[model samples]
Target: MLKEKVYAADGDVHPDQQRIYGRGTELMDAEELVSLHVHDGKCILDLYLRKSKEISVLVIGMHGTRHKVAVDIFSTIKQLKKHLYWENNFCLEGKVLMFNGIHLDDSATFSNYNIDDKSVLYALEIPENHMNIKIRISTRDITSVFLSKSETIKNLKLMIRQHTFIPVDQQELTLHDTVLEDNKTLFEYFQDQEDGQILTLSLIHHIRISLTVCINMFKSSDYVVQSVSLLGSDTIEMLTQIVYQRVFILPKQQQLKKNGQILEHSKTLSKSNLTNGDIIFVDILPLCKITINLGEGHKPITVEILPNDTISEVKDHIQKESGILMNNRCLLHEGAVLEDHKSVDDYDIKDGSILFLSQRPPELVTLTFQRTSGEVSELKFNPRDPVSVQSTIQNIIKGENESASKSHVYECKQF
Candidate 1:
């Protein structure tokens, strides 16, 4: 059976203390317990809905406790507080009620709640329509505005424009690839999903002009160029995606720009001011593509590394795929050892440059063990451990034998 270690942190302290939690361990003043079950020889964590039962709910107002009610799956909020006369008892009437963290509507039932297996129910006080959906415009300007999901896209645009000063006409709201219509409600788009889902907004500006542009790839004086028909109304972001698709680049790795200015997805192509037949440079990152030459006979492996990643991370990734240890390998860029602390940009490495990967001399050790049939097995240790020939069983099990002087060598093999 597979065993796994689980860790949890205590949030009550200034510096949060992390602790490994075992199966069936109680958590946070015994409020919850960690449970586990084995599936296909792997331990799976079980923390939800072991059993279900009716739970007591405490409903509160802005002032104080309004009602203490018992609720079950079939019970509705309307049934619990129907007895209170809101016109006379204005204290209880105006005060909005909440269950757990969600604001409760009159139609909201206990079935809507995500209940615990312990039959515990929670209700609290919050302002009316407190549940709000956050809308994010773009990663560059990540200022998020929250409003009720019941609000229409038109109202959402107005709210966002009020804060950003971006004209409502330029705003384009989208969920995945589908565009949100101004008349449609936000809840109508995400009601099928969970409540309070995040909606991404894309801003598009319309302009009128037709231009044919040529995209060229120049590497070591060799060129591969393609011509694309573009409109002034097309967004720079959209053009970036189209160019990347045509160039056979994965969407995530596509970084295209002209001049020194990185293209913003929300801006129109015309705003960047490119007339007909203007040349837009594709390679924005200095060290976008690199070739790692692994000595003689082995074909050179080429990879694309992100600009943000350090030299050490790239080396580690190479080690995983090539079965070469990071400590045993040294990366030489133009005959100089690359430092782990510096980024790829610091070395002035460019696309298609060859980086040499030189390996250190390996250390070998001799291991000897005896089988149940009274036959001795001995061999020089190799890094690639295979079953039957593996060193794990001999190192872990056979190493426990007190006769190390007769069966084991003092030399350690570098893995």
Candidate 2:
């Protein structure tokens, strides 16, 4: 019989102890520290007392230096980290240990990963904590989170789970067309990112996932890509509403295209063949043109407004185009005033409707009244009509405790 001497890091257990080398033995957990080799009520082998061979490992430190160290193959990575820290006076925390791109678990043994004399391990140093990541939803709601640099991508998903209802396993993060692995660190992913910090408050945080989409809008008769963040579950109709907030185009007046195919409004962004950071082309749908006469004698301005837009919103657009303060402007349709809070649909405003852009209670107009006794008096009022100015003045006199009928006769004339 060939028997071997064993020295174990687990007090006498190793990953190799779980190997089913004999048909008579059942597999056991590495942490069980017991290898009952009895089969058919008879013992076959005592492998738990076996010792693994020593292996030389080359460690690539953060500064790019290489150090070869010999250690037992059954030693846990935690023990190796402790030895590295004591020998080189290295950092004891915020370090990510990796072997062949695999994140090494502190509780896992080197032999479990099949490490040999020629194996190389990377020890990367990172910030200890206070790394903030902001996750955003398609609705533009954001959630802000601060995580430890020592944390793994798996930890990141767990952090995301705390803020959103999405499960950790269901969450997928991506960057620049590559899916981020669970074992990777944020420092590895966002090392070059320049996302500056805000006031530690995000509207709601939804982390960067491969599910974001970009918008390409038509501007100046050509397409310009806008870095608009969107979620996969957002429907094309919802996308239109999101786009409308920026472009002022109604959903009905907007058509989206992906891969040169027109995207349906009822379909989700993902169903439209849109992927993370994919450019969704937008074209303004045909809209009804309304004639807005800037002033009494000014040339008519052609404007397209959505039916759902309020008069206040229309005033905002006019302010942008004509450089007029919305509060100082008012719209007149068919000789009736358009209230700011009302919508175009409320007014039944349609295509080719003539809207008069005018000022409210315009600058004072002067009027002179000639009394029968050869006396002249001046009356000033902001009027809707010159013809109503006389009646308005008469009402003002009545309010002042004077009867306009009993007052001396006078003929009014505009100055």
Candidate 3:
């Protein structure tokens, strides 16, 4: 039978007590210790044990050079010291050995022999199973409304460029890295493209408008002047009123220039020459149909009208017939405000043209009450309370009781 042997660090070989291996052969050499790499579970255990001890010294420095070291014992300190010596050539000198940011020892020497410059050291004692893994998360940017003019596109581009996007050809001037040659509309650039590119362009335009509006307001003191200062229907009405005022107040002027000479004091014209006497005489066509969607309470109605009648007149007639007041209502053409003075002459209201007449939602009156012990403790009604039927009933009962008492008194007097 073969006798087992155990090898010690001192180069002395001893027979194993259990007699597990043959005795004639020496126990596995120190090189064999390299084969016994620490497993994940064993490394974890070692980490816990090492952390349990008082960490008096902590060395934080870049990894110098890493070379494998042969050690009989399995420990982080032994491995690290081996690597440290490997870095500085067997001498532990000129290295910072820190404890809580304070240097403990400048030249702490290791007892282990055969340490080399190529050995790697980690005084922090990271687990051998430690691994670095990377993960990625993706997001999307989208917008619904384009609300700014072309002049503000540069600022808008700066605001949205961080989100990873492409700009339309019309917006090329807006981007610092893009170039433009001739004039091109945004729609032209997006034309003949796949749905994805189209959608991206749409999103970019929408984002541009949003960013421009926001930046302009942030930089300017008159944000309210640019944007209507109300929510929902109020905003629409305010915008319409402003448009009406501008159209009515601003004087129309035409520039008359000849032979590179400017003419001053030109007469004001009500209508542009583009539509003046060049008009083709056409019969006043009837409104194919007028479709009205009032948001709530009534089904959409389609009506016909004569082309000679103005949109405001049509709205007034509709208001009278439908019992809908025009004072609080707005006329919308294709979801935009229909100017009160805009002629319906050139533009015919076709059968399918959607005309939306929106009214401001009615103000809500809240009646709040507090209940205690199955009875209302306090009641508050808005817009003042109405005359109650219960109060009238109580008054009638009191009057009847008074009449009965009087009749009884009369009877008593007669007796």
Pick by lDDT: which candidate is best?
2
| Ten residues in sequence with the least summed lDDT for candidate 1 | 1-10
Ranking, lDDT, top scorer first = 2, 1, 3
In TM-score terms, which candidate is top?
2
Taking the tens digit of each residue's C-alpha lDDT, what string does model 2 give over 1-415?
A: 0111232334455434434344455432211112232335564544544467899998888888777778998888888888877886665376666665445556556765667887998877533433546554322222344555556888777755644456565566654436667898876766654332211222222222232234445455455445565655557797778778866767777767767888889986556766554566777644557888897656777777877678998888777777767677789998889999998989988989989888775677787776545666677776776667777667545544343355655578776
Q: Model 3: per-residue lDDT, tens digit, 296-353?
A: 7877766665555577877876776677788757777755666667655535566667
- Clashing residue pairs in candidate 3 (N, C-alpha, C atoms within 3 angstroms): 66-118, 67-118, 67-119, 86-116, 86-117, 87-117
The lDDT for every candidate, in the order shown, is 0.54, 0.62, 0.34
- Candidate 1 vs 3: which has more lDDT: 1
Which structure is stronger by TM-score: 1 or 2?
A: 2
How far in Å is the alpha carbon of 196 misplaced in model 3? 94
| Error in Å for residue 132 of model 3 | 99
Segments of candidate 3 deviating more than 4 angstroms: 1-284, 345-348, 360-415
User: By summed lDDT, which 10 consecutive residues of candidate 2 come out lowest?
Assistant: 28-37
Candidate with better lDDT, 2 vs 3: 2
